[model samples]
Target chain A: MTLRRIFSFLFLLNILSCKTDSEILPSISKEDIQIKWPDYFPQPEYNFENNSLTKEGFYLGKKLFYDPILSKDSTISCGSCHQSFVAFAHADHKLSHGINNLQGIRNAPGLYNLIWQKSFFWDGGARHIELQPIAPIINPVEMGETIDHVVYKLRRNNAYKSLFNKAFMSDSITSQLLLKALAQFMGALISTNSKYDRYIQNPKMNPFTDDEKDGLALFENKCSSCHPAPLFTDGFFRNNGLDSTFIDSGRYRITNLPSDWGKFKVPSLRNVEVTYPYMHNGRFETLEQVLEHYNNGVLQSVTLDPLLRNGIALNNTEKRKIITFLKTLTDRDFIQDKRFSE
Target chain B: MQRQHTLIFIILFIFFKMKSILKVSLITLIVIIGFSSCKKDRKIDVNTEDPSIDKPDNQEKFGTVSIVFSSKAGNSDLELDSVKYTNAHGDSLTISKFKYYLSNFKLIKDDGTVYKQEESYHLINRSNGKTYTVELENVPVGTYNSLNYLLGVDSARNTSGAQTGALDPALNMFWSWNQGYIFLLFEGTSPASQSFNQALSFHIGGFTLPYNCIRSISPSFGSQNVLVTEGHNSTIFVNTDVLKMFESPHLIKFSQVSESLGGAIGSSISDNAANMFSIASIQN
Candidate 1:
């Protein structure tokens, strides 16, 4: 080719190489992360601002999430506590770890498609997904970093400067851009394709085992009130016959009242198989121990939910069945999602 | 060098696009002003007469009201029980200071029209005085019939997340774990204990079920028809003397109040403490 034509050809290549502009999705896009949930699920309380999915924003949030720059000494990151392998919950530790090996007051809930959550955390403290990260970022025992400080540091970084520019229209790292990106990632972490979902969706094709069926029945009768299936939670805080005196205070921490003492948000059991050592404080070491607590060890308190006040009665065979049912909540698809892995 | 040129072109394009947006906004603003003036009095017969002719300064006339808050604690003006900080049994219980949240505030016009405050949720530090004060601005020169304000931060902002300045959590008004904000910080000793003898503080708030604390307060002193302008101060006050907080079956004692009973404590103290702070406490 002639030199002039070669130059023209290069120009055309650049134009062709440039992918279509990442326009705001009119609906969930192929690149747009999908939020998997069952059909029986209620319409999400969080309204998407006209299908507000963006790749740049989600990736930036993911990068910031894994980066420790959000911490005070740049030591700990959100990933420090919320590792993906453990379903975004603090693995093994009774309490979440933070900056300088600091311990948090409550166990960090596994991060996921929180747009459906009416409330967040064990105490139901965080009302909005966008605002939830601010708690960990600023909590003294958590990251111990202020939103403003995070914005300032991101503004100074060459990497974040480009990342913020791609995520937001401007490189100016306001709280809005930072939060929007985080919310994008959090809202997109949906976990729906479990064996239980498949079994329920197609009862005949993907049959549940006899043991699993028995477990399901037991779960429906005993655990359905609080740990309602589908979402696996009713989204209300309850004492669960945990204690009489308010050690953690649970929901009562937000309101200055007595009735809500020790009440905590009923967590969804989507990945209970892998997310072991359950309960608000990570007090129960095994699933069997938790079943025993529900079966007979439930502590009596004034605020305890009446349904669970008597403790869920079950035989040894029934307990084994319940464990099998609980295992069905695991979504290996989520654990293996390329989008979430480090 | 070629890649650098491409980046430069893209950057310049974005800059030009932003400038175009600014230019469009400016043109729209001029058009709006032109249309408004043209539309306001379209059929004027050389302006027959401006009603202001008879009362020359009537249209420009302004009046001021100073609000005073006094509670019937047997005759003393309703002041906070004490200026002492918090030291209840719970360490999270200590309050360095107390502040009230008021937002989306609007002054109702006598003509049923509303003149909204530029920054509606007015954060008045009651610690300064029994009376919280604000000056009305660009009010379209009207006689306002009354003042109306949300007793706490609006639900929109509560769910919106980590706001700064007056809404900053450094104010200690925010609960980091539980997402909702504590609208009122009532840090006073309850007569429930003997450790140094003080009342327990009731940090009453929670904008959710079983304990929503968002309240509406119109100074019970009744409406004051006042004209406002670019240069005038409006005073609003609140009285905590209602004896309403203790009206509940359970009395709040400092010895018993802990962080554990957080949002639920709202029901006991909200009715009394919600109206405890007044907007118009003095004449400005």
Candidate 2:
């Protein structure tokens, strides 16, 4: 080759190499990270802007979520309550089973599409997603570990040190970084591939059965006011008139308002099939019981929802049809996804 | 024909050897250039250096100002969780918890120039007696006549998202439900209190309008200024009287009014908190 051509060739090679290097850079590339959700879904409340999501952070958080080292006794992990199967909800257990078989007061809710949730917990105590893990970690019955102790333990471990180094670019393992890592993992759980999601995405591709269609119509007319579509929750606290008097003040404990008595967050109905024993206290076992309560068993109270004042007028056939529609919300892919499992 | 073939082969072999050498030299040059360029692009990586006990301040002519908080009731030092003192209302009291947030620290110069510490939020607890003395580093070298501080967590910090260090909600100073800091927490048992065992609990904090409880306090040093110079260590002794909390604008009798959860009583406590502290001594 000529001297001029050789110079040109080297110049071209340098440009090509630089381009390739930039592509493989370790910085969190949002383009590479795939957060799967149907187009019909609204913008996530957690945009992952403050704590940007990275593959390394997600993996580290996954490990932390499953690892019992986060607990005081080194026996209970977050996954002990929020398992991947049954849509991250502790199935069969009405109330959450904590460390040393200690029973928690409330049912452990399913953990998917959490990025959309404005406030965490049934009572809506934790305002930020980053602050949510701290509550469980120090709850005495749950993980039973202090934030400092968890950081201290993680700092000493070689595996966690390397993971932290990769995730946060620091092996110091600060509480902020630890919480952020957990948030990344929890926020990545997007459950939008159920039969309902498919039907919503393309009305013809995944056609609903006649019973499911009738149930969906009934659900839209009756339940859609509180348990809305797309995300399956309006994200508002309401007194569904489950009881005349509440033992657990629910949202009232957080708000300290008389009107907020017996008010609990309208939980997302997605994956509600496997995540049974519903409600803030897990009072009801089956969807039939839940339907039966709404149909005729709703008690009158001071803070009872105006929508449920007259009670949902549903016959036995209509209730069965509604139950069938609720089953379509069960996302099998989400529960079996190996990405979240131990 | 064999001689011609051999000559051609020799020339070809020499040319191939020279090309290989050139390729090796070019590759070496590229590697050197690549490394040098990579090094040139500043990598803002983690501080891999050992954690320092004292953070090295890069500012010029700055010194540390340590403020010592001493809780007092009348002549004797107030002991926590033990009934020892009487309030202004002649009520025998035992304070169990006397923790409050102090923030927006400012050092007022003789000329009225203020040196405000950025993000200066400190949780002072009587339970943790050792932490009562808050050491403020990197204070500018100057003669400060008065030191001003807010007795509560500011509305800005309260509304902001999750914070770390002293402001972390995990520290137990933050109110998870109200979404604000419990700025002044004074829990004790008084003989005049109506509750069981004469328990007088005051969780005074609210950052919203109509109940905003943030109080700014500029302690008077009385013409004697705190001198801050390079390498100079100084201690500003501040005396805090819990008795003052019950007195001043709002005469809160333990028997009549004890708990100030979040209304008018909470707002008035901030006013009382302002008068609760007095500058005792400033040693340079």
Worst 10 residues of 2 chain B by lDDT: B38-47
For each candidate, what is the lDDT? Answer: 0.67, 0.81
List runs of model 2 lying over 4 Å from the truth. Answer: A1-26, A29-33, B1-37, B43-71, B74-83, B106-116, B127-149, B155-162, B174-181, B187-239, B248-250, B255-271, B278-284
Per-prediction interface RMSD in Å: 14.1, 4.1
lDDT tens digits, residue span A174-288, model 2 = 8878888998889898898899988887889899999999999999998999989888899999999888988989977665568889899999999999998899888899999
Place model 1 in a CAPRI quality band. Answer: incorrect
Best by DockQ: 2
TM-score of 2: 0.80
First chain TM-score for all predictions: 0.90, 0.95
Output DockQ, candidate 2: 0.20
Task: Give the alpha carbon lDDT tens digit for every residue of A141-245 in model 1.
Answer: 888988778878888889888888766657477766777777878788888788898998998998999999999999998889888867898888888876667
How many pairs of residues collide in model 2?
0
User: What does candidate 2's lDDT look like per residue over B193-222, in tens digits?
Assistant: 888778888888877666788998988899
Question: What's model 1's TM-score?
Answer: 0.69
Best by TM-score: 2
